[model samples]
Target: MNQQNHFALGLITLIIFLFLLGPLAIIFVASFEPTSVLQFPPTGFSLEWYRNIFTVSAFMDTFKLSMFISFLGNLCALLLGIPAAYALSRFDFRGKGLLNAIFVSPILIPGTVLGFTFLRYLIVSYSLPLEAALFIGHTILMLPFIIRVIASSMANFDFSIEEAAMNLGSSRIGAFFRVIIPNIKSGIIAGVLIAFLESFNNVDISVFLTGPGLSTLPIQMLTYVEHYFDPTVAAISVLLMIFTAVFMFLIERLVGLSHFTKR
Candidate 1:
């Protein structure tokens, strides 16, 4: 009976993995199709679509823009979230719960609604530039992950460490920079990696905020799909999958998958 159950569970797990990864495998194979159209069990293998990705000016331009937004947005989130996480984790204060809720509201809200709200208020009313709007939207989107991850790291932290550092002649800020920050370095890296992935692949917010001459990679991919039915997008998807996998591997190496799983 035990062997039967174990075999069934193993089979189920395998099926689930295939279900999740099957489309990715199809896309990877489809990207190598010789013809322009995306086809399953590709007619013949070729790297034409891969080469075509570079030839498209829009893809390169949007790739640069997406990279810029994702990097800067996560950096800004880390800067703000570290202090906020420290405050929430280490101190007691009035309205702390409400403040935390406010910080996390972005994740709770649907991206489409949030994007529309930003478009109406920031773009139409205040006349903010597309770049500025995108920056702010991505930053806000990242805040929840940053704060939550860093706060989790600080949860078991000993407050006395900061006191000890201060007693040793370090200032409050000095103790934070020298001791607290270094201690939670893994958490910071994890948060930034997660947030960067989120921001880079974001389409809902970028779609609304994007204007003429300013678009994200995901948005451009969507546009490409609408107008053309080709394996180029499939090739792009394959590259993005590899990129994401590499980042995930890095995160696991730096912070350990166990760190997140334990939380």
Candidate 2:
């Protein structure tokens, strides 16, 4: 690209980033305010808000609930996503395009539709546990992302490594573990991380499925925000953002962000 074009592109990108992050930046800064109401350019700063976060029994309970649910959701997505990805990447069958479309279309479907569809199924036919329903619904939402990540990784991996391992007397499972896995480790790790993140941040599905005596952090935050608008929510938002950033940073350091791409 020419210098002028590059400069213009950079300016546009900066504007976009600022637009996206400005509200979040304001929330983070206001979170430390030593006041009752959420405000910007605070009169003072203190750790009291975070301390208050710890004292809230509801926040702790909801945080744990979110962690547990996200874990289960990611597990289910991986169990189903990995094999489906392998099939789509490694083997071609009749109606392959149709099957692939069905698998991935969930990603394009709106979260509201996904939530309402699962809610209807649970209410009418299955009558499944709310937690299980949430798990399944989140899997529907996140599974496509996982499968696509894994498949993209698989595409970039050379199959000859697996063939070589098999030819050298490794068992099928052994070859997969010792050869294929190591080669595709980055993709799998990225998929798992992204799946966990998507599952963690889910609201639409969880909000619909959650009943009395159960709530995730996002639901709790939504409820809390509805009832009271204040810097406490901002405190929680900053904490959540920090936690996610640190986690993603660790993963990127270990696995390398490049691993997430087929290139």
TM-score of 2: 0.90
Provide the clash count, candidate 1. 0
lDDT of candidate 1 over 115-231, digit per residue (tens) = 999999999999999999999999999999899888988986898999999999999999999999999998899889989999999988889999888999999999999999999
The runs of at least 3 residues in candidate 2 whose Cα sits more than 4 Å from the true structure, single-residue gaps closed, are 1-10, 254-263
Cα error, candidate 2, residue 44 (Å):
1.0
Tell me each candidate's RMSD, in Å, in order: 1.3, 2.4
Q: Give the per-residue Cα lDDT of candidate 1 at 62.
A: 98
Query: Which candidate leads the pack in TM-score?
Result: 1
Candidate 1: deviation at residue 1, Å? 3.0
Off by over 4 Å in 1: none
Q: Whole-model lDDT, candidate 2? A: 0.83
> Could you tell me the lDDT of residue 8 within candidate 1?
100
